[model samples]
Target: MTATCLLPLFETSYVAGEGPDRFYAWPDALILPQKVRGFYVGFLTYTYHKGGFYLLEGWFSWFIVIWTVILLGLMSIGGYFMFRKFLKRLPKEDGMSILDWEEHYINETRHLWDEEQKQLLDELVSPVPELFRDVAKSKIAGKIGELALEEKASKITEDLIIKGYIVATPKRDHKFLIKKLNEKQIDYSRYQSLLAK
Candidate 1:
């Protein structure tokens, strides 16, 4: 596992953040090293001359190593900026990422949803914007499914779905949820217990 600790150090030394290289290299770097020894990179070859590592293999290998390093550095640094530019960091709930929590319930109880509940779910998420409609529907459905499992209910129901939607939504988005509920003529008074929270 010496390569495990050393490869990324050598690769990322020229980069700022953990680049795609980290993800891309692990399958080979960490896994192969367990089956082989010594520093074995594709382009970055090393020699034990004078008891020090040097890029003195040849002009071509030297250029390849330099090119690879520069590319890795740019990608590692760019990945962070790209993350800021593209991805939205969802707030964690109960000390877990929202996406993680979403997968948990969906994996556990997705079969609990019947065709009627699925139809109702489509209607409920109808008012959501097209871009986020899928996420909203999945979140609401995941929560509903989670509640059904928690309460040991045999099947999902309208009340369970409504309650799950409220609990799954953040307080800031409640206005939209409330507005949609009003448009759909769903009563919030019955969910007064959840609303008060």
Candidate 2:
């Protein structure tokens, strides 16, 4: 409601011998009386200063405000340490995150991919924007290189590049991947098994 419609309520805030007398006479509508009572308790309980200003000049108010800040700082520091400890406990291959291993694998197999595989990787990642295309190609190559190292294969193949492209793409972006696959006239049905993974 506009301020004019609410003028009646705002004009009724009268202090009696003990407390606000206006809140006691609100219409007994469903839950409205309780809401008005809550509003009165929230505003009237705080003693206001004169000059129509809302400056809270008191020691107790300052103490509570400072204490809340101190507690928030303590909680944030504690939570950070707790998260670090938790991350340290998860099992890792070579004691590194996935991104680090991807880089390592990419370097290890950098010499193994023939020119054909390199061209295929470039084509597969072309759908990505120019800004992120290099990063996307590196990640896809790393994934394909990782599988080669796992199987101890001597070189990368068309199948490995295609599978890695699909696997590296997030599920949310699979539609774009499918569109790219269709544009290239590659049969995506053959990769349904990898997509299911």
Indicate which candidate wins on lDDT.
Answer: 1
Tell me the TM-score of model 1.
Answer: 0.47
Model 2, 69-161: lDDT tens digits are 698899999899678756645548768766677788999998888998788778767778997788688778888988888889888987788
TM-score of each: 0.47, 0.50
- Expressed as tens digits, the lDDT of each residue in 1-197 for candidate 1 is 11111222233322222533222222233222111266545444433333333322358655766777898999998898667534434554466665667778887887777899888778777768897789788888778878988899878888898888889887676677678678878788888778768
| TM value for model 2 | 0.50
For model 1, give the RMSD to the true fold. 14.9
Enumerate residue pairs that collide in model 1: none
